[model samples]
Target chain A: MISPIGWFIIWLGILFDILGTIGLVRFPDVYNRLQASTKCVTLGTFGIMVGIFLLKGFSPMGIKALICGAFLLLTSPVAAHALMKGSLHFGTKMWKGSVVDKYGEDKLGGEQIEKEG
Target chain B: MRYVLYFIIGFCLWLLLTLSVNLDHLIVGVVVVLLGTVLFGGYFTDKPIKFLQIHRLFWFIVYIPVFIWYMFQANIDVAYRALHPERPIKPGIVKIKTTLKTNIAKVFLANSITLTPGTMTCEIDGDYLYIHWIWVQSELVDKASEIIASRFEKWLRRIFE
Candidate 1:
């Protein structure tokens, strides 16, 4: 059974998860959704992993949870960056409310090599 | 020496992951790390000794708490905007430059910006990092970079460089 503190942390993680999902659905554009889903989901999952570690203590399960959390932190931003770079290169328009487009301005109206990566 | 360092790091990672001090586990970990070091260690940093520097390790330990603090603040800020009816956001892309010479340092800087609230790194081109800002308070490149990357850069420079 999970301790009270562990349960609290788990609930916090679930709350973040819900907020991130709401952000994902309600955001106007792809980039905004990426920001919400990527950052929030990474933190939410990492929090859940931390909760699991606290519940299990220093045993194998807890150690595994920590490792999973570390990997999540390392990889989520990479995925987000890749998605954003692809979308921008393919000319996905920013929302009308967006204030500026520096990337578009500098690299504007130019064809990019598809297999650049 | 680099290979030895790689082997030791790999062994330590295995110990942490497996969390077992049994004799059999030790034997298997050593064998696996030996193979891994042989196959992949060459790609690791040329100056693996830098990893052993006391200041770097100390700063890294110190950085963890600061990062977590910023992350908490970011979540609160984003959560507020998400729950707000008008979504009081002034989203835009902005270009900022990092003074950190090392690519690894720049990578960490980019990752930190993305992980934090109000900013997401869209691209890194040499010294320049293009960011998607949730709230565009500053339009100037120097000002934006200062706001976005300077906090982490101060610590990362000492640790990585």
Candidate 2:
């Protein structure tokens, strides 16, 4: 009884999920991969869950789907934030080609390690 | 009045999703939702509600599909990278400038950036977003900021601000 639109949305979600995974692989580092995975997967999952809800109507399954979607939306970004904070705390370096590091002077105390050493 | 409206909306949402009209559930839901609204009332200042245009809200619905499509593309990209044994990661932090002026829009952009795979909004100072990217694909930092402001900011401004 699922409408074509529902199926299409589900397919779109699947496609996003796949693309996010690919971005994670092709991306240069942990932070970049986190960016690729967290944003895309969260929204992608939401879309799929919405599709499921529409197809299943107001059944328990649909309710569970909605809950899952909400949980993902709420927690995924928080988790990403934690990961980034952890990486920064642990002294992860930026790529060399990176043009700007706004936090570098502030975060690293504005003292060049080479000069101090 | 706003609290009352919120309570009603919360109760209606609960009822619609739960699809239960049993007297016990209705009473409990109403009590809980009203209590939540009462608790939330303490957080807001006594400012009057800003006049929000209904037409602006409609754009959010239109933007949803675009967000979905972008998400789909990001998902596949992340999944493939994860499976790769080589783990071609270029990890780095980049400063991304944002045009969103309001706190809500900045929050939305930060959350949106975090939600997308391979990027995280590490910090937001004024109009700048300190984003950590997994890869530095060309001018990745500039691209990210532009993407956030252009793709999501306008819609979020419409919906919440």
Candidate 3:
């Protein structure tokens, strides 16, 4: 059985996950949706995993949860970055509420990135 | 040197995975870790060792709580915007300069920015990082880096640079 504190954390993570889904549905454009979902889900899953680790203590399963959480933390940002880069190169339009676009302004676009990529 | 680090990491991971105390586990883990390290350790850089120095390690330990607090704030920031009736947001892609020199440090800086409130790195080009921000607080590059990267950049510089 999960302690009350662990339960609370798990619930909090669930709430964040739901909110991220809401953001995915509600946000205006691909970039907005991508970032909103990525960050929230990363933190959400991490929180839940840590909560599970708390609930399970020193069990092998518990340690795996911690390892999985660390992997998520390390990988999700790279995924977000790659997606964002792909979206930009694909020329996905930014939302109208956007104030600026430094990416489009000075970037040499696909060629330079691929050479270094 | 990198193999040594890999061996230690793999051995610890094996111990955690088994959660056991046995000579057999130890022998198997050592053999497996050694073989694994020999095969893959060449891929990793020895440069990260500088990051493991005493003062830098101390900064890393101190940095964790700070990072978690910012991450918590970032989540709350997202929730507030997502839940608000108007979805108050001023999205933009802005350019910012990072003073940190190393690729690893810049990567850490970029990841930290993504996890922090309202900013995600779109591209990293040399000293400049283009960021997608939920709120465009300042259009000026200097001011923007000050806002977006300064907090974590300071700590990252201490640890990695």
Candidate 4:
């Protein structure tokens, strides 16, 4: 049987995941959605995995959960970065309410080179 | 030395995966690890090994818990923003310059930023990292750096310096 603390942590993770899904629907743009999803997967899923590891102790299954958590930690951001890069490249407009856009400025210079050539 | 380090890592991974104590498993692990080290050990630069100094390793050990604490804080922060009806988020991409010189260190910083509160590294062009922040507190680079990475940058510097 899982400890109450373990169950609580798992519930928190689920709550974070559900919030992320809500952010996916509520956010104004791709970038915002990416932020929400990345954080959710990284924290929520890893939290649940850690809870499982705690519940299972040091058995092979427990160790596997730890390894999987590490893998998720390492990979999720890279995946988010790739998605963000792709979105930027495809010119998915930033939310109008965004306060700044250094990416736009950088891309403007790149565009000038494209126009000249 | 690098080859030995690779062999040790490979063997440890083998042990972890198999969770075995048999002599046969040990021998097979050694053989496979040796082959793996021979084949791919050259890919690991000396930089990582240099950062593996005892002092640096200690700081890295210390860094993990702090990182986890911040990660939890970040989750709550994001969760609050997501769940609130108003969404209370002012998103933007801000440029921040990192003094970290090594590619591996910069990569670590970028990954750390992505995992930390309210910031996701969008792109890195040299020392300048473009970060997508869920809450746009400041457009100034120094202030943004302070807000986003002051806690992590100091510790990471000690580890990677």
Candidate 5:
């Protein structure tokens, strides 16, 4: 039987996933929405994986869950990084309130506009 | 030596999670894992051994559980903000200065910050990290910088410095 904690985690995961979707919809810009989606969804997925592991015990299915969790953890951030880098490279403008543009005087000395791929 | 490390990590992880001691399963696992490691070794043969320091790997293992705890804590905070009716999100970007000098440590810190809920690493400029935080918990941007540097950077330095 799944423990109370496992059920709680599952519910929390669902709650967080829904919240992330809401943030994605409500956020004003691409960067903000990306932040909401990537961070919340990753944690939500992780919580669900942990709950599944607890419910399934140490069976092969649990092992598979762990593997999936690890993969998700490793790839999600990398994918987000790639997306951000690509956006920046493509000259996507930040929200007006953005405080800093550290890349404005980039050392690479590339052109103001990224070369079209 | 690299293959040996890979084999041991794979075997131990398998054993610990499976908690199995059957000789047949052990043999099969070892053979399959070892073969995989051999095939994988080709991908890293050009990289120097010093780059993947064994002692650093040990520290990384020691730090993972602590990192997970921090992640869980961040997850709860994000979930709370997300579920609250007020939505209480400031939705701003903050520049946090980092002390990690090496590229590896900087990459680790950037990835770690991005992985944690509610914060995203927007840009890594030398020792500065431009982060987009969903909720501005601290008024002082330095406070967030200190929090990340002290919590994850120290451990990452131990692993990679």
Candidate 6:
């Protein structure tokens, strides 16, 4: 039987997923949306994996969940980096309220526009 | 010696992936790790002794819990900004400099920054990293670096150096 703590952790993951979805809709622009989806959903998924591990203890499925947790930790940020680069390259535009644009000042920002991938 | 490190890592991965303890599986794991070590061990480190330093391993063990704590903090911080009624975000790309000298250290720093809340590493030029921060609390590079990287940098240096 799954313990109460395991169920609670699963609920927390669901909550985070819901918050991420809300963030995607509520945030001002693509960049903000990306932040919400990447950070929140990744953490939420990690939580679910941990919860599964808790429920299963040292069984094979539990060990698999732990491995998945490690993979999620390593890969999520790389995926976020790629998404940010692609969005910037395509000139998707940031929120007008944004206070700074270091990329706009850099030559690389414009260079990406002409290159074909 | 480097081959030993490679074998251990490879065996661990094999064990994790297969979740098996049969003699045939054990033999297969030994073969895979041996072949893998022959092919890739030297590529990871030229000085096996340096790479396997006890001090570095200790630091890595210490770092894991600290990193997890930071991850939790980051999630809460971002969740607050994402959910707040005002959405008090002052997003900006700020340049922050690193004291780390090695390429691997720099890579680790960049990945850590990207993972943490409020900041994302967009570009790295020499000693400077341009980060996209969700909340632009400070404009100074030193201040930004202190806020974003100070937690992870010292431990990373210990491990990578």
Candidate achieving the largest DockQ: 4
Estimate, for each residue in B1-161, the C-alpha lDDT of model 6 and write its tens digit.
Answer: 77787788889988987899999999988988898889888777656676658999899789878877766677787778777888888887778889998877887788788767878877778999988888888878899889988878889989988
Model 4 chain B TM at 0.88
Clashing pairs in 4: none
Each candidate's fnat, listed in order, reads 0.64, 0.52, 0.75, 0.76, 0.31, 0.59
**lDDT, residue B82, model 5:** 57
lDDT of 2 at B127: 82
Candidate 4 lDDT:
0.83
Off by over 4 Å in 1: A110-117, B21-39
Model 4, span B1-161: residue lDDT tens = 88878877778888997788899999999988899989999986665577457998899899888888888888788788888988798888888988888777787898889987889998889988999998989999999888887777898898887
What tens digits encode model 2's per-residue C-alpha lDDT throughout A25-102?
666555665677776677778889989988887787888788788768768887888887787667776544344454
- Which regions of candidate 6 are displaced past 4 Å? A109-117, B1-4, B23-47
Candidate 2 CAPRI level: acceptable
Question: Which of candidates 3 and 6 reaches a greater lDDT?
Answer: 3
Across residues A1-117, which tens digit of lDDT does each residue of candidate 4 receive?
567777788888898889888878888788889988898768899889888888888999888888888889889989999999888887777776777788778764421111111
Instruction: State how far residue B29 of model 5 sits from its true place (Å).
Output: 8.0
The 10 consecutive residues of candidate 2 chain B with the worst lDDT sum are B43-52
lDDT of 5 at A16: 76
Question: For residues A1-117, could you state the per-residue lDDT of candidate 1 as single tens digits?
Answer: 567788788888889889999888888788889988887788888889999999999889999999999989889999999999999987788887888888887887532212212
Error of 3 at B87 (Å): 1.4
Q: Report the Cα lDDT for residue A95, model 4.
A: 74
Winner on DockQ between 4 and 6 is 4
Model 2 over residues B77-148: C-alpha lDDT tens digits? 566666678865555556778777767567767877765545667888788877666565544657766754
Q: Which residue segments of model 4 deviate by more than 4 Å?
A: A110-117, B22-40
List per-candidate RMSD values in Å. 4.2, 4.8, 4.6, 4.1, 5.7, 4.2
Writing each residue's lDDT as its tens digit, candidate 3 over A1-117 gives: 567778788889999999989988888888888877987898899999999999988788889999999889889999999999998987777877777887887874422212111
**Ranking of all predicted structures according to TM-score, beginning with the best and ending with the worst:** 1, 3, 4, 6, 2, 5
lDDT of each: 0.87, 0.68, 0.86, 0.83, 0.73, 0.80
Is candidate 4 or 6 superior in TM-score? 4
lDDT measured at residue B87 in model 4 versus the true structure, 0 to 100:
79
